[model samples]
Target: MFMNLLRENKIVAGILTILRLYLGYAWFTAGLGKIQSGAFNASGFLGNAVANPVKGPDGSVVYAWYVKFLESFAIPNVDIFNFIVPWGETLVGLGLMLGCLTTAAAFFGLVMNFSFFLAGTVSHIPTDLFLGFIILAAGYNAGRIGLDRWVVPFIRKTVLKGKEPAKQHA
Candidate 1:
């Protein structure tokens, strides 16, 4: 029922626009700061996350697999993360802000939010995740007042050009 309102209601879409803009601004600023720092490194953070993994109530590692992944793949490939994090955030911000690909933007934003949560850095993750899910659920309507209003239809027409069912003679 709530999802239906988010996806189909014009009034709700207007509200979502506000949330989208807010999330987009947050993402843009974070990425911009990292890009400008000229010393943004993920290795240190990844190492720390692995060292102090999220723990369960019993004091056992809650995400042992994630810790291992960070120690193995993430640390070894820190350079990739250094590049992807900033750039991906910036692109997601732009997409959401412009409402060009709002759903994709929200989706990626949620991914980062979850990654941060898994790394045991909650902060704004809960709120961001909540809003992102809302935007994602809203789908095309989320961007109905923005670029997706036209971009979606254009892409659909172009991609589906020859894939339509053939008409039969009466």
Candidate 2:
């Protein structure tokens, strides 16, 4: 019976489940902490740029451009990003925790990681973590006892037309 397979598959599934849960907890905790603090409204990146001051050398205009971008774009939307980013993280965490559409969550989470990594500085962790999660979620039903087992199939029915999303890789 399928139950036998589920039990047999528990080891891999358990690991994935634990990973998802812990990562989700980490994300949610960070997001919630950010939300609790009053530091949300501060001009985040712009403030960093101004305070840290990444001055360009000689004829290089990169720093100036960065400053300009931070001042103009980043400063204006700091509040928006503060709100959106934390909530997005929280949602990703929740989805991953429940293993609901885990691949989708992992996909979006991967995107978030890439964006942060591209932003430069201390981004390697997120980049590596994202890739690892993607690898684990790829193929196989590590989500047997989690919501993903049901959600994925339903998604297949409604969206992909009974075709599951391709697993990432081995």
Candidate 3:
């Protein structure tokens, strides 16, 4: 019921647009700051996550695999992270804010939010995740009031231009 409303209702799209704008602004500012500073690095954050991984009640590492991943992959390739983080965030923000590819934007936002949570950085993540989920779940309706009104159809036509529906085997 609620899901249908979120995915189909224009009224709900308006509400979702507000959430999208707010979340988009947050991402854009954060990313733009990093890009502008020209000093943004992922090594420190990734190193810290490795040093202090999430632990269980028994003092055992809850996500040991994630710790290993950070240590072996993320930290080792911090340069890649440094390059991608800011650009990725900024692109995601632009997409969401302009509603160009809203669902895709929300998907990436959730990915980053979860990555942060996994790394134990818990500032504004919960709220971002909550709202991001709503926007993602709402699908196209979330961007019904924005550029998606035209962009989506254009993309669909361009991509599926020659594609035909499958024939039914009677």
Candidate 4:
């Protein structure tokens, strides 16, 4: 019942828009700061994550595999992270703020949030993850006030044509 309202109701949609804008602003500012710094690099961050992964109650690494992956793939490819992180954050912000692809943007934002959380960075990740989930759960309604209002329908009509059921005989 509540999910239905969140997915369809205008009042809930308005609330979601506010949430989306706030999240977008956060992402935009973070990314913009990195870009503006002109020397922002993910190597230090990735190194820190690899050095101090989230620990379990038993004092063992909670995400050992992820730490390994980061060491093997991410740390070596720090150059890629240097490029992808800031730009990806900025793009996610733009997509969410403009409501162009709200669900996708929120999904990616959640992925990044989880990554940070798993890397022992608590910060605002829990709140961001919760809000990202809300935006995703709201789904199409989340983007109804923005470009997805038109773009989604256009894609459904054109790209997904010929998939609709034809009229059946009595």
Candidate 5:
């Protein structure tokens, strides 16, 4: 059954691969810029900026709902978070480009986009596109033409074979 589904979904896998490549390059370029400009520390407007509203669990912000949400979890100096964000983007971009762990890469891309979207920076459209890309990666069979195809099948055959029905139907 699963093999039939995989056989029928070649086009979907291709499209997902293309989407992965495009988003991967986009994310890689963005992260590259941050690395070049030394902005990964997040001293810029978005990262360094403090979340306003200063809510006290009452869900009320003087400015915007988004601000309140930010105040709750968007504290700055997040040095560890800052350090990982850009590198994570870069690695995810590479993974997408190479079609290795493509689904996981897309998942991280979606998360990064969600974080940006929550910033209310008017780039939600692309973020939405990224989210869609993640869904596509999860739904389609991208492993056939990618590393996942080789690795996952081996794992399934070796590890999951025990769970499959016997040749004699038991």
Candidate 6:
């Protein structure tokens, strides 16, 4: 029911536009800061996350597998992280802000949010994750007020081979 409203209601779409802009601004600033900081590096951050994976009440790592994966893959490839983290955030922010490929942008945003959560950093992630899910749930309506309004239809018509309805003879 709520999802229907989000997907079909213009009022809800307007509200979503506000949410999208807010999240986009947040991401843009964060990424821009990181890019501007010549000394920015993910090595220390990734190492800390691996060293202190979120612990359960019993003091065991809640996401042991994730921790191991980070150790094996992420930690060893800090250089790649150095490039991906900042630029990815920037691109995601731009996509969300422009309402272009909104679902994909929101999806990636949620992925980053979850990654941060799993890394035991609980800042604005919980709120961001919830909002990101809402944006994703809204689907096409989420981008209705922005570029997706045109881009989605273009893709459907050109790439997906959507056909126009036939006109009746008068």
Quote model 6's TM-score.
0.93
User: lDDT tens string, model 2, 11-90?
Assistant: 75776677778777776776777777846554655476555654345634445555666678767778777777777777
Q: Could you give the candidate ranking by lDDT, starting with the highest?
A: 3, 6, 1, 4, 2, 5
Local distance difference test scores for all models: 0.88, 0.63, 0.90, 0.88, 0.61, 0.89
TM-score attained by model 1: 0.92
Clashing pairs in 5: 143-149
- The candidate with the higher lDDT, 2 or 3, is 3
Off by over 4 Å in 4: 162-170
TM-score of 3: 0.93
Question: For residues 90-116, what per-residue lDDT tens digits would candidate 6 score against the true structure?
Answer: 988888898999999999999988988
- Which residue pairs show collisions in model 6? none
CA lDDT, candidate 5, residue 12: 64
Stretches off by above 4 angstroms in model 3 are 162-170
TM-score of each: 0.92, 0.66, 0.93, 0.92, 0.66, 0.93
Better of 4 and 6 by lDDT: 6
lDDT of 5 by residue, 1-170 (tens): 54444334787678666766777787787777766777566434343333432334677543465554444554444565677777887887777777777667777777767566555444545754654465343542654567877766666589898364344221
lDDT, candidate 1, 6-87, per-residue tens: 7779998888888889999999889989999978899888988998999989999999988888888999999999999998
Q: After the best TM-score superposition of candidate 4, give how far the Cα of residue 41 lies from its true spot, in angstroms.
A: 0.7
Q: After superposition, how far is residue 38 of candidate 2 from its true place, in Å?
A: 5.6
Count the clashes in each prediction.
0, 0, 0, 0, 1, 0
Stretches of candidate 5 off by over 4 Å are 1-8, 46-73, 127-131, 134-140, 154-170
